[model samples]
Target: MKTALALLVGSVMLAGAADAQEKTIRVSYETPPAHIKSRTIEFFKEELEKTSDGYFKVELYPSAQLLGPSEEVAATARGQIEMSAPYFSYIAPVEPLMNIYQAPLVFDSYEQLWKFLETDEAKALAARLESRNLMPTGYWFENPTRLWGKEPLRTLADVQGKKIRTVPSEILQKAVEAMGAQPTAIPGTELYLALQQGVADGAFTAPNYGLTMKYYEVTEAVTKLDLFLGGYLVLFNKRWYDALPEDRQQQLMDAVAASRAFNEENVQKDLAKVDDDLRAVGQQVIELTPEALAEFRDALAPLYGTLDPQIQAMIEQVRGL
Candidate 1:
């Protein structure tokens, strides 16, 4: 009888162990298949499954199939979703330091920008996400910011009084105002319609958006502003991540590391392709003159004081680096 009891206990334990090994990650984003964010997540899925020997599986929901950008951060925090890659501006209201990501003309170059992210201050700011049940364990950099419009926006005078769609960041809205355009906050899913319906005369986007999402289809011009580097931070439910075994956690991070190579290589290439593609479709690719760039810089200079003092100081410190 004791032998029979031991056999039953062993059967149940084996079942529980099998269950623990099969972890399913559901990741949602608001971009279509061709966007870099989608591509990055696809690579991450492939690497994670392969490295974990199929013990881990990732399910992706793209083009707002599961949740829109505005809903992702709150839903992920509530554990309504396992993962979501929302823009940093969308995360900023809950995590203030994130607001800096949307602020225009901050970091001077990619080297300086990446160096700043490695600093102690940035890590502490990222740590604050966990307090609200969200974990930013990984991130994907989108293309640098630029303005796309229905008409030529080659100079500050040309931008005046135009209605422009912008991100959820207030600093960016101020930047739009500084450029002399009206700022309207619109979700990515609805941007094409917004432009078509004249809800916005112009909008902000990366070169990838013009190529993949077909923003060039609606736009008449692409202005080179070289605004701040925008990003989509992967926010996982903290509870779900903390419950994972240490090995599993490391496996997930390894997958993110492996998936970055494509984005690092292709971001600039996409811009050059976009310039050619836009002209082929008969749209103007506007380059700002030295005088026009100076006007833009002078307009944006005073807006830096609007940041939270701590975030302002952190940015100032990074610029000096």
Candidate 2:
């Protein structure tokens, strides 16, 4: 009888072990799987599952399968979703300080951007995000936004009188106006048609956007303005994260670090390919000289003063980096 009891006890323990390895975590984002944002999450999923020894499963819902871009952060915060990668601009309205990313010429390279993100200033910003019930773990540098148009935007004067499609933000709109261009907020779905039909003269966005959405089909020139390094933030529900065991938490952070590195490397490589692909298709790729970029930067200087003081300080810190 004692031997029979031991066998039953061992069977129950084995079942519990099997159940423990079946944990599931769901992640969502608005971008297509081909985009870096979604690809980064894929890396995160891989690292997490490997690090946890198959104990964690990450289900990626790309292309807004679970939630739209604007709805991601709120949904994560409410614990309706385990994780989400949402555009930084979408969070700017709720947290005005986050607008530092939109300040033109603030971050010229991915290295500079990452250096600033590792600083205390970024920690405070992360804390602010945590206050909203979401924990920001990593940042995905989506792409370097540039000015592309029917004609090359070679000089500060080139932007004058041209209507450009931009993400509708007060700061961005003001920046566009300051550069002597009108900022038109057009949906991504309509951007290609807008440019093709002459509704807008050009658009300011990532180069991949032109490639993916086939904006290159209509636009003839692209200037590497290196205006702003747009990013998507990886967020987890704070309450959920806090509920994890200490070991589990450490494993998650480690996985996040690995995933971030993977993303940074891949994004850099992809950008180079995108440039080549754009050029291969007969698009005029304009590599801006230092002098020309300086002229454009100087013309947009007034925008620095328009930002909130804290945001301005953050920009200064990044510039110093």
Top-scoring candidate (TM-score): 1
lDDT string for model 2 (271-303, tens) is 878778889887888888889888887878998
Candidate 1 structure lDDT: 0.82
Give the TM-score (vs. native) of candidate 2: 0.86
Clashing pairs in 1: none
Q: What is the C-alpha RMSD of each candidate to the true structure, in Å?
A: 2.6, 4.5
> Residue 241 error for model 2, in Å?
1.7
lDDT of 1 by residue, 1-321 (tens): 999999999999997875663487888788899888888889889999999998888989998898888888999888788788788899888988787777788877767777877888888888899999998776678777788898888888888899988877787888999888899988877888888889999998776765676777788888988777867777788888888889988998788767766666666567557678778877788889999998988888888887889878887887798
Candidate 1: residue 210 lDDT (0-100): 59
Point out where model 1 deviates above 4 Å: 1-22
